[model samples]
Target: MASGQVKSAAFVLLLLNLLLYFIVTVMAVWAVNHAIVRSRKTASVLTIPARIFPIYFPVGNMATGFLVIFSLIAGIVGMATSATGYLNVTDGKIQNLHAAAASSLVTLFLTFLAMGLACKEINIGWIDANLRTLEVLVIFVSATQLFCAGAIHARVSEVATILNIYGSGRV
Candidate 1:
């Protein structure tokens, strides 16, 4: 594939990842806050359980959403700097790329955990279904981004040399 095409794909994937995570985060916050508000309306006795698994699901979703967003931002920045090869492959950018990859891994794990909790609690509610779909898409896109970023970063010079290109902008 052409370098430009790779970079373009990276940009688009990153954008989609960002948008999906943003939506998921907003929905999660809304769901969580709604529950909290409803809980506050009740005057029931405070039955504090030492191990309440229900709360962790929403919290995990919220955390995953935030991490996914961070990954998306890093991916977008790295891809956009493709034209400036050194800038794209520098320590900061590499860190960003790795951060994104790590975030994706964490998100994938958290997503499955949340889904399992949902299955146990709600038997696949509408919100859970949507979140699951979004989570899968993000996982796929982020994984692709990580693979491409690693290859591009590792052999950027080789690619340019093989193609008989000049200058750092060869990427």
Candidate 2:
């Protein structure tokens, strides 16, 4: 595709990712808070399960803790990545573009990690509706993040080619 088209696509994807990441972050925070609250003894009888170190979600299986933590990290990183990508795309600067691309790559990896944990949680069975929503969102975010990163990389190559900037550093 042409440079303009690639840039536009990247911008749109970044915007979408930014919004989704915000939602994911909010959900993660809620989940963590809920887990902590639920783990605490509310009554004299103490009916809840034993509280484990770090965190022990009462809703899902063992993978729930890991999934929530990873999702939170990925959400934060994804937000920053999307913002950097949007700036770079708008400014059309090679250095900013490189930064954006690198951040996007990092976000993609984190998203994938969260996605794997989500899948494991799903497989384990016992997740709540909130977790299921997060799982779906993380999966979707991974796909969009992949496309956004690819578009940025493609734009970098296109710019380098047009400017005759070679890896030899002679340009």
Instruction: Give the Å shift of residue 45 in candidate 1.
Output: 6.9
Winning model by TM-score? 2
Model 1, which residues run further than 4 Å from truth? 42-170
The models' CA-based lDDT, in order, is 0.44, 0.85
- Clashes per candidate, residues 3 or more apart or on different chains: 0, 0
Give the number of the best model, judged by lDDT.
Answer: 2
Candidate 2 lDDT over residue span 10-123, tens digit each: 989999999999999999999989887876553224444443345567667889889999999999989988987898878877777788889899999999999999999999
Model 1, 110-148: lDDT tens digits are: 544544443433343334554565445445544544554
RMSD of 1: 7.5
Pairs of residues clashing in candidate 1: none
Which segments of model 2 are wrong by more than 4 Å?
A: 42-50, 165-171
Tell me each candidate's TM-score: 0.45, 0.89
The alpha-carbon deviation from the true structure for residue 52 of candidate 1, after best TM-score superposition, in angstroms, is: 6.9
